[model samples]
Target: MVALIATAFVQTGFAQHDHATHQTQSSALLPLYYNIKDALVVGNASLAAAKAGEFVEALKNADAKIVTGANRDGLLEHSGKIAGSKDLKSQREHFAGLSTDMIALAKGSKLSTEPVYQMYCPMKKTSWLSSEKTVKNPYYGSAMLTCGKVVETIK
Candidate 1:
């Protein structure tokens, strides 16, 4: 009985350690994600595309244990689309999908020490993750810069 209890405790410790490692690994993607979002907010298609490409590479290089298979694939697909396109419209469209997957992932896992805001744009009918509480619409850029509201905050 003592041996069994010892084994269980050891397993629990490993589980906790794995979870902490996963959180750290997952949080690494947030900066890259923010880079793409910032590029979009400025209406810079070339920069957005470049950032998206970097994001794709980061996603691919991320620890596989950090994200579920479906979520990772969704991220890869949307970011890949954005990376392959230089048109602002196309990049923004793909960003919507990428944001969806990112929001889901961020919601499930602790992505940062600070609160991460999930903003919603009624005009675009889409949501995105932001490190800031202030709204800066990436979909319409400066045209509707402050067009969204914080729908949720992931701490």
Candidate 2:
């Protein structure tokens, strides 16, 4: 009975460690996501595509337990679309979907140590995440720069 108890304790400890590790890995994806968003904000489709490709590689490297099901599928799908396209319009279109999934992921997980702002574009009717409170609308770039407002702050 004592041996069984020890085994159970060890198992519980390992489970907790796995969960903590998963959270850390999930948080690591934020920088990669931001890279793509920053590229879009600058109106650089090629850079955005390159960043999307890098984000995809980061996701692929993440532990399988970090993201699962629809979350994983959506991230891969949207980022892959952006990575494959060189056209700014096409990349931005895919970015909306990618941002949606990213927002969901950010909301569902403790993805950052600092507050993350969720900014909304009234014109595009879409939202994206940012490490800062100030909005640099990725949807419209400089055409309508500062077009969005901070809709939520994920702490």
User: Per-candidate RMSD vs. true structure?
Assistant: 2.9, 1.9
**Per-prediction backbone clash count:** 0, 0
lDDT of 1 by residue, 1-44 (tens): 99999999999999999888777778888988999999999999
TM-score: which candidate is best?
A: 2
Model 1 stretches with alpha carbons more than 4 Å out: 1-21
Weakest ten-residue segment in model 2 by summed lDDT: 60-69
What lDDT tens digits, residue by residue, belong to model 2 across residues 1-84?
999999999999999998888887899889989999999999999999999999998888878766778888999999999999
The lDDT of model 2 is 0.91
Query: What would the TM-score be for candidate 2 when compared with the true structure?
Result: 0.89
Q: Global lDDT of each model?
A: 0.92, 0.91
